[model samples]
Target: MDAVSKENEVRLRKGTSLNERLVLAGIAVILCLIALPGLAHLANGQWLGIAALFALLFGCLLLGAALFERNVVWIITPGEILIGEQRPFGKLHRRLIRDDEVSGMRLRKSIGKSVEFTLVFETESKDTLTSPPLPDITQVRKTTLQIAWLLQLPAPELAENPLDAANPRIRLGKPISFKRVRAYRALVVLLACSLSLPFIYALWSGKLSALGIAVWSLGAIMAFVLIRYLYRTSAFWIVHDGAIRFERLSLKGTTETDTVSGDDVEAIDVESGGRKDSLYVITIRLRTGKKIRSPPLAGKDQTHAVQAEIIRRLRLNSSGDA
Candidate 1:
């Protein structure tokens, strides 16, 4: 048997659940009903409503099957790793890994802090496969590490917050720092500036209304809204020790910690961009396979130190020499 098939024999469990499918179907039905009104005029709305009702009934049946079915496994074992979506309509998301095409897995962040550890592999074809939305936190994290290790990839350096593992149920404190806005807020600011430019030029060149004071007032409102939106987008945060903290601000506030054990963490990585005046970006790959990246705006020194600390911890825990 191939390695994948062997691994499947050892680790594959019936992971799928009927209840999960029912839930997905139910959600889909709800969406369909929501769209029924918009399409109602096409068939006097009768067909749309009937279609939505049928969908809802089908969802209920699937839910019922999920609630009572035991022989049906929630998770299916494909030769390769596939993410079984919790929703009913979800099909198996297959992942195909080739032996020679494999590269080391690394934990990285994508847009909007959707933290994930990606298995790096080189293939002649540029197609990519992403697992469906993960089912749970622990499973996701565990999967990231397992896949990385299997491919002989360096585990991403992730920060450990003992308090988070000790008390996952409670909300841990976040750093209230401006540096937190580094990643997302920076994008927002750039977009805002881009949007405001034409408008500002229009006002300045007298091409549009410099008419009443409303022009200036409207300009101010637009600027304010853009600034505020940028602020909100910059709100990426992380929890450490006993505090919930924001990256840009220096103040540490108290919050309840979660109950997850520290040993549960799977992978962590720190990344920084730019050489001169480089910004620090810290990414925590959780046991759930979900990764979170702290925004770069948090200041260079602080991020570097945090990265070092995380690397130190990972090195200590790791069996290989640093």
Candidate 2:
């Protein structure tokens, strides 16, 4: 990541590092090499070989995409702010926001850690233009200040207001539970097994040399690791009786629970990309300055609903004590 400033304009650019790109390119090359043997099996009309070949090629394509990931760039001038993503093919997808349209800018931190931050431009129309997540908040803050000065806008500050919960309380007749099950883990296991099929076949057919055996061994280990990841125990959240509970079920059938009482709750805030379908992180702030966050929940409506109910329960508890 680097920034360049000139008399008329300032430019900020960020992308994958050279070492990261080289690693992805190397993996892509290996996948292509693995696909070569599967090509010969295509003439034999073998279904397994065909599936393996497709999987290998698909993996290569995915790696290639990673190797040439789109680079994010921001150009700030006296009149307007331009945000663009430069693709590997030299195509740029850009958006322009004139100075008149932007009301202010703010920095927002992600739920889990303060390291990840986003710079958001608030428009007069209630719409927002947000920068990609950047790990260094200091850098983001500096860039935000520079842009605000260039655009003649207010200095950016951290956005930390709690989400409004003044709507009618939502009654929960029973405990609300949210389960965490990542479907992507299963997809990864499937892909790993598919990529290993050809090597397994080659070994079974006694056509594998010493080098082939090593590659097959590595594939087997990778498949095992992915399978384990797919079946790993997961945690869930339960909101009930004026408290939020986190429970994790272990593979050995043991369950652990931790609870946070509503009495200590200070506020309920949400972090998101300001989109209806964007993932929302609901954070519970305590009087002690502690924060308990829910896992990334999909959709604005669902997350806001949960937030409202939690606030409702907290109020009910406070009223009862009075």
Supply candidate 2's per-residue lDDT for 127: 93
Summarize candidate 1's per-residue lDDT along 1-322 as a digit string, tens digits.
0012233321332334455655765775676566556455445656656676666566566556554433211222332333332333445443445534433333433323322223333434654443322222223345545554544555644324222223332221243445554455567657667766777787678776646346556766776665555444333344444232333321232222233223545555556645435455666555677655555533443454445444443442442122
What do the candidate models score in CA lDDT, each in turn?
0.44, 0.65
Q: Which candidate has the top score in TM-score?
A: 2
lDDT of 1: 0.44
lDDT by residue for model 2 (1-322), tens: 5567666677867787667777777787787777777777788889867976896878778687875688998888997989898766678898888999998777776765222456788899999877665432224445556667788888876453222122222222222222333355556667877887887798789887899888878887876675555333354566664676766544443556677776777778777834444677677777888876665655454455466557665663322221
Decoy 1 TM-score against native: 0.31
The TM-score of predicted model 2 comes to: 0.39
Candidate 1 residue spans exceeding 4 A from truth: 1-20, 23-113, 118-218, 225-322
Structure candidate 2, residue pairs in collision:
none
* lDDT score for residue 212 of model 1: 37
Candidate 2: lDDT over CA atoms?
0.65
